[model samples]
Target: MGHRARSRTRRNCPSLQEQLVHTTFLEELVFWTVKFEFPQKMVCLLLIMLPDTDYKEALTQAFVLHYSRISMMLERSTDPDTLSNRVVHVSVQLFSNESLAFRMAENLNLLHVMVISLKYMMGKILIQNTLHDADKNFHYVVDCGRQVMKEHCYWPLVSDLNNVLSHRPVAVKFMSDDNLLEMWFTFLAMFQGMNVNQREMTQHVEYEPNTYYAAFSAELEASAYPMWALVSHLIDSSSIDLTKRVLTSCLIALQDWLDAINFTHPHMNDSMQVSFHLPLHRYFSVFMCQAIKHQGLSLQEILPPRDVLTLIMMHPLRVQCFHWFPTFILTITITIISSHLISSHRDMERMSGVTWATISLTPLGISDEFMQPGQRMRD
Candidate 1:
């Protein structure tokens, strides 16, 4: 149904609380009036029970709209607890439906909102040497970490965003906007710095290893791998200038991530195994080659410089080079086509007095222009 018709259907349905009251059989079971103080709880229940109907679609739209609005408000929130709750609501809506996840990213604003939320939560948890009492701060740190993780939103936020960004056209639109693109790199920088602090904290903690910290730290890497991998899909489909820009940013981000992370950290290695299985190494290498071929960029003029290339190829998180035979063949094919076009252009320029004409007749049969042609015209 059209959005207007669907919105009208939603308005005609009972109020959210009434739908909950009717669906839950509260009228038959409760003798006294019962009010739901937490409307999100009721909305969650309604989402679960509502069958296939326009009402469900409307509710889904309402939830997505709510998520969009709240996400924008996250930056202004002062209460961490309130911010966490609002972030959790966004996470719930994102996980509830794939279409909702898509709608959240449709306008490309949610991506930046998510970055702000993640950075805020990470900043809270990464607070180190701020308090004099080590004992009190440890508990506080754990609580901050737990707040963002309450609904599996911590990892799923990055992972699901990667899933939603699987749409190339949407991704390109996102990457095209300078503000949104800057936000993406800013996220990478924030993630890198937060991870460095996390690793240091892991190394310095005096108490026994807390599984909660371990799980949270592990999920951090799980989130990181997907966020890094998210851009690989866009490289092949973008315009040459954009592809160059994206590849450059991606390399710089990867370099920053690799430089900051301690691979030997106990939790980090396995988390890498869990999330770093993406063939981004392969994607970047291949697309870099393709970009070079299309732009006729010499190795000396290639993006990221030769030294960075060496770093990427040698590092633990190095780009895995594969499909050599096909890539080789494709490069050769492109070279031949480029040569042929150059030679054809020269030949076209050498032809003197070459002109193109179309079949023509005027009001007077066979016009003077057509009759006077001895100008090497071809019709």
Candidate 2:
């Protein structure tokens, strides 16, 4: 009787083990399917299960997952235009949820990345959406812009402006006031940071003469576009404080460039060589001239045409073989004096001689026409 009972117990134990194995396999399959189907729910569940300190990594992972999913959607969609517009829609919906903001603020670095990604995605969306239906799409863009500024203070949002400026299509027009202000402050912060970093780098170079000026020049040149955009916006908005800051930064940057130029080629120390300087100098000069003009300054007020020409001629690194400064100075000076001659006949004669003297003093030799005293009387 004891042997029979033991045999029966062993047979029932195998059946019980089979049942347990089958139940475990089914449970595993169900869990994976549920995880695949409801990722956000799973994330929320995990967040609830884990301690608060562990939420940062989970939040970052979730943000990255969303970004990946959006990217995949953008790639797979047949209609990029519609998909781009939808990106803003999705961002707006997420932003409206207060809980997301709280979660984002918990991890500032992740928050920065998320905001940058959203701004970039939204900017692209506005551009694409406005391509066909500019009026309607622009209204939507303005709304989004306002929402962004309202939700995220303008100053904090500035951290992402450089990326937006670099990535957005240059041709896209900004119509919203909020967009304009956001851009303005962002640009301000970007240049401000760049200026700080550049100064630090420049200080390092003071002891290292072997450091190539070209390397520093390249770094300065990289910031030109963003600087121009900032200055241009300040000019457009007529923001005096912002404009002053831009001018101050510009002067600092210009002084640095001048130092680099002088360091690289000490021979061309004269101001006249400014015109004959490298292509970058010419580009920067042109931008400066335009910026001055936009600010309503006459050419003479900033610096006489002759002086500008002289600076160009004296620039040591003449990329061009011919010294065009003399001709350029003479032409511009003549035009100015001619325009002035009509307004004030008496002042013209005296002004022409003074201008001629200025040009001659510049690194360039004066033309025979200007040198001949009697000739100046008629022309």
**TM match of model 1 to true structure:** 0.42
Q: Looking at model 1, which ten-residue stretch has the lowest summed lDDT? A: 351-360
Query: TM-score of every model?
Result: 0.42, 0.28
- The CA lDDT at 326 in model 1 is 21
Q: What local distance difference test score does each model get?
A: 0.38, 0.33
Residue 209 miss distance in model 1 (angstroms): 4.0
Tell me the alpha-carbon RMSD of every candidate.
22.8, 24.1
Q: What is the C-alpha lDDT profile of model 2 across 285-344, one tens digit per residue?
A: 433444344554444443434434444333322322223332321222333345532245
Top model number, TM-score: 1
lDDT (Cα, tens digit) per residue for candidate 1, span 127-189: 432111234322112232344434333453454456556555556655565445544554444
lDDT for model 1 comes to 0.38
Residue-level lDDT for 208 in candidate 1: 37
